[model samples]
Target: ARWSPSGDRIAFVSNSGEGSEIYVYWNTSNTTSKLTQLENGPSSISWSPDGKHIAFTMKVNAKAPVIASMPAKPKGAKWAKPPRITDRLKHEADGAGYLKPGFNHIFVISSEGGTPRQITTGNFNHGGNISWSSDSKNLVYSGNRNENWEYDFRNSELYSSNINTKEITALTDRNGPDYASKVSPDGKHIAYLGYEDKVQTYQLTQLQLMKSNGENKKVLSNKLDRSINTAIWASDSKGMYISFDDKGKTKIAFIDLAGNISDIVENVGGTTLGRPYASGSFSVSNSGKIAYTYSRPDRPADIAMVTKKNKKPIVITAVNDDLINYRTMGEMEEVWYKSSVDGRDIQGWIVYPPNYDSNKKYPLLVENHGGPILNYGNRFSTEIQLYAAAGYIVFYPNPRGSTSYGEEFGNLLYNNYPGEDYNDVMDGVDTLLKRGVTSEDKLYVTGGSAGGIMTAWIIGKNSRFEAAVVAKPVMNWISKTLVADNYYGYANSRYPGQPWENFENYWKFSPISLVGNVETPTMVMVGMNDLRTPPSEAKQLYHALKLRKIETVLVEIPEASHGIASRPSNLITKVAHTLAWFEKFK
Candidate 1:
């Protein structure tokens, strides 16, 4: 989506027939016009400073496959399917299916309506975070045009291209991937985020500053150890505001000319629509007004506006007011306790069954989050709320390796993921058990992706839980490194070496290695089309349990990917299946 330079109008893409088309709407007049009819969807859209034209990124069609011969047949004779051949390492992606042969390129069209013209030409794909200079003469974007662009994925550089002359110039020359350049209001400096490619398991993305000519590059966030998720320059250019996570909570802060950091707001997220995960966005206007999505433990993101510093924000839109007013929600409570294995504090949230009795114990459901790099915070979660509504006490913990914590804590599982994280979560369960909030007989555990790995790990290590539902987990590292959507990072950065060099360590970390001890009635679930943690991974655990004469069932959500809850119906199905499994054991 592209907001006009004057902020008077907005242009966005929408689905049209078989593809997508661009449209512009006037905020004042409430008038809209169809702009372009393109074959493929436009990925990025940018409005020119004068609002006379729009620049966007669209995929260029890949060349047709080369076939040795074509067999002649009758009018409608059946032909054998062509085999896919590719020398590229990164080919297909989840949700996108087998990738089409194409690269993303930049294009521009007049706001008055005309044929769109292609700007940048290359075999390599151009990426988003496209920024236009104040004069509207040039466009800056990130891409890797090197010979081995695909293999050297972490070597993107910032480049500028003249809109008319088509002349290109390299702005920043760095080994690491550098993009997301936002030209300052004065157009003298550019603020972007990147880090040197040290090939480490975890590296913080530092906010950087450089001249318009790409000189005198400095890391503005050098002192900040936590990663910067988003950065926007203040209207004056003397400082910039950034949003980052700290210890499972997301906050927005401002960094001034003297390198002083002052928080503008805490708890800056509620963007995770389905669950309480760390996600949100903020934007600043030239008039110094800030607009963001406000969220809390009780509600999802609502439109909020703030003009003054350290002042309360006025929420403009209450998206969930009707639902919130009508439906009774579970009570959310924050819980903090030290890890039993290590003397470190762990954060989690517990949702109690509505109209609960403090004296009576309740069934416990431990939900693990994906992205050992992601976190669960004080945000409204539908999945958690649904479990609570089902008369279960739900606990979602941000264990070690969860982000929003500092770099050290996020990288704690660098070489030991699903290892000590188990202890951290089990300790959280123990905390509730000791308080008599949950009884051992009614314990249940479930998680997806990385959480799925932990769920499998939990049942294998301990049988305290009555039932388990492991969803979309990497049952074996060797297979995951080969088939997972992210084929490179799993071994290269997460571990020190390739599977061949570190076979012993890889085998040791795999959840399947300990499946022999499984005795719990486990339900292995996965998305039928999950590329991140393929169905094979779930099958491995199912087969392992069956071989041990253990009670187990495999559930595959049809037409779903890594994110099983991506669709509304799928989310309901996931929750239904989970509750059924847990209830059966109870």
Candidate 2:
């Protein structure tokens, strides 16, 4: 959703009905109007400077119904289904399945309503970092136009298309991706984020500067060690402000044309509605006011704004207060301790049981986050709070390889994940025990995706935790790299070489390889329809543990994808089942 250039109207998309439609609301007239109807929703909406047209990316070449020859029966006829012919390497994706033979092309239509015009056409898809020139004559966006784009997911370049002539020109030529173009206020320069292609699992995205014509490119944030998210140019056009995660918190910073940097605000998060994971965004207006989703431990995201430094943000919305005010929430405290393995500082948070007493020891329930790249921060989390509410002390940590931290921390597990990271979690657990908060004999651990990988690895390494639940984990790295939807990119960037080239290394990292030492009663959970970390990974571990005489149970959520808690009912079920398993063991 975006406000028009003139600020007199707002343009947004709605998918409430059978199809997605674009609508515009007039502030003066106090009336709403539908601009256009689309077969599929478009993304990255860019309103022209003159407020005459809007540019967006939409999928082209809609597939026609597959026809089959069949003989009709008496009255009730049954026809054979048409066979699907697939020829793409990256054919299917989570949430969206079965990639059709089409491309995401840029299109433009009048603000009032008219026939949409196709601006760019090719085999490759174009989206993200879309912006219109101040003159409204051209629109710039980022896309991978290079050949073998599907194979090389990270090779994308910036391109600009003439609104009238429909001619497209490449703006940046580099091995790595350069995207998220934001035209400066004066329209003389473009600020975007990019990095050199080292083919490593992690790399810092440097904030770059280039002339309007895409010349004199220079990296304005070369000194910053963390990856820059996005930049919104200052009203003066002298420098730009960028948001990045450092350690366990998200901070907003400024980068000048001379490569100098400074911090603006800290604790800029709360966009992630589900878990207390790292996520947030901010937008700066031309008048120097900054609006962002503010995060806190007691509540979810609330709209807040700031106009000056060192001043408290004025929260303008109380969307969750109606329910939060009536609930008795648990207390969340920040924990900082050194990793037991290498003495690296690990940031974590512990939620005390509701109506807790310091003298009483509660059972510890350590929750591990997925991504292994994503980090948990000081935000409202339903799952963690629910655990604490059930008379259990919940612990979540941002170990090595967690983002919001600098590049060095995030790359700690580049090729050595589930290695020292296991030590980090154990150290966090030890810290809680030392603090006299949790009982040592009734420890429980659970995690999803990469977190699931760590949970399995932890149980294999040590039996301190009495019960374990690993959700959607990759028990065997060799099989995971071959069958996962993003095998090409994951296998190459995450590891040194192909599965056969680095067979020993792959085996060394697989949790199934160490299943012989398991003694803890473990439960394996996965979404039945998950493609990212397939259920087969869970079955392999379950079977391996069973063969070793280890008590194990497999819990598969039907009709669910990689995200098991995508629906409200599923979230309730996942929490209820996990808590039930822990109660049974207790």
Candidate 3:
């Protein structure tokens, strides 16, 4: 939902079985009105400063590719459905399967309600979060309009489009992503986030500022090491409110024009229920008031508000009170340790069993977070709580490759993943053991995706864990790099060149390469219809363990995607399965 410039009206979209449609509500009258009959809902809906119109991005479908086929069916005969054809490079996605031959374009409609007009024309997907000029006569957006956009997917340029003339002007021309434009209310400046393509495993996006006419570009947050995720201009345009990950927590702060950043609040995420991944959003009002998602370790998310007058945030919603408040929540503690590989500091979070006793011994469940670049912070997580409630101490570490530790640290896995990250995690585990939080005999491990890769690598490196569950892992990098949904995307960034070109290097980092020495009882699980890591990747581990006469179980969840915990049922299934598997060994 988005509030209009007038603050008296708000606009939002809703799905009514058919598709998403636009709706507007007037705060003064307490009345709502339907604005669109759209089958595919609009996104990035923004109201003009004058509140005379609203602009949004909507998808425009194109004709699918047609080819020569067999003869036509008989007059009244029923035949099979025609095969779907596609020639696009990145055709399918994880949750969203197959490609819809369409492009997102900007549209505008009057505030009183009327037909919407398309202002941009292209076969490219114009991103959302579009910014408009103070007069609302122009709009700035990001898109990969280059001819080779299919192959050069990483490169995107910010472009300004005139509402009346519909003239498009390119504002950025670098070989990296330049997106999320925010036109200052004064119409003098435009703030965006991007970074030049260094062609590495990970790169931090810097906050950039430029004139409205696209002149005098400069990096505003150069001195800051962490990647800024969101930015909003102050009412007076003196500075901007920005959000970034520091250590393992997401923080909201105000960054001035001179690059001085001051903290506003911490613990900015809890929207992701399945995992403790950093996720949340906030918006600033014209009066310098801010509204955002308030998060806690015991709750999912609640509506919170803050004003410049009062820096203290007032959480206005207790959406999970009925359920979360009634349940016993485990205690969460943040721990830091020195990586054994190097003396570099590493961060991790531990969830002790509910009503814990320091005198009692409990099994240790090492849950590795995915991304290898994404950090798991102290956020409310269903899976983490379940594991902790199941009577085990849970540890999820943000290793060397995790973000929020500067770009150098995140890119530490560049061409050398499963390298120092393995040691970083082990160091954390060993630290816990030394503190008497857990014992070696009751150690268990599990993770999905990159986390799964790490779990496999950890077990292969040492038989320390009594049981292991590896979910949706890329066992063989060579096979995974070529078969996964993002087949063409990971080549040069992950390792060097194509998988075949650097066969030995790819195989060296593959978890399957070390599976020969595995002795821990393992459970291999994956979504049957997963496209990211694919079920075959899990099958590789299951097959290898079987061939070696190792104890293993393959759990293929039907009709699920790479995100096995996307559905609430799936989330419960995953946690239950992991707990069940670990129980046997415990």
lDDT of 1 by residue, 421-519 (tens): 999999999999999998989999999998899999999899999999999999999888888877865666788788888988888899999998888
Say which candidate scores most in lDDT: 3
lDDT by residue (175-249, candidate 2, tens digit) is 999999998878999988889888766788889999999999998888888888879999899988888877767
Q: Which stretches of candidate 3 lie over 4 Å from their true place?
A: none
Candidate 1: lDDT over CA atoms? Answer: 0.86
Error of 1 at 548 (Å): 2.0
Among the numbered candidates, top TM-score falls to 3
Off by more than 4 A, model 2:
62-77
Q: Candidate 1: lDDT of 197?
A: 83
Model 3, span 1-586: residue lDDT tens: 8888878999998885478988899999999998987747789898888888888999899988999777978999999888999988888888888878888899888877889989999888787578889998998999988998889898999999999999999999999999989998799999999999999999999999999999999999998999999999998988899999989888889988888888888868889889999999888877888888888887798989886567788998988899877888999999999988879989999999999999988999999999988989989999999999999999999998899989999999999988989999999999999999888898999999999999999999999999999999999999998888799989889899998799999999999999999999999999988999999999999999999999999999989999999999999899999999998887
Indicate the TM-score of model 2: 0.95
lDDT, candidate 3, residue 238?
A: 83
Residue 307 error, candidate 1, Å: 3.1
**Candidate with better TM-score, 1 vs 2:** 1
- Which run of 10 residues does model 1 get worst, by summed lDDT? 303-312
Clashing pairs in 2: 245-404, 246-404, 247-405
Q: Which is superior by lDDT, 2 or 3? A: 3
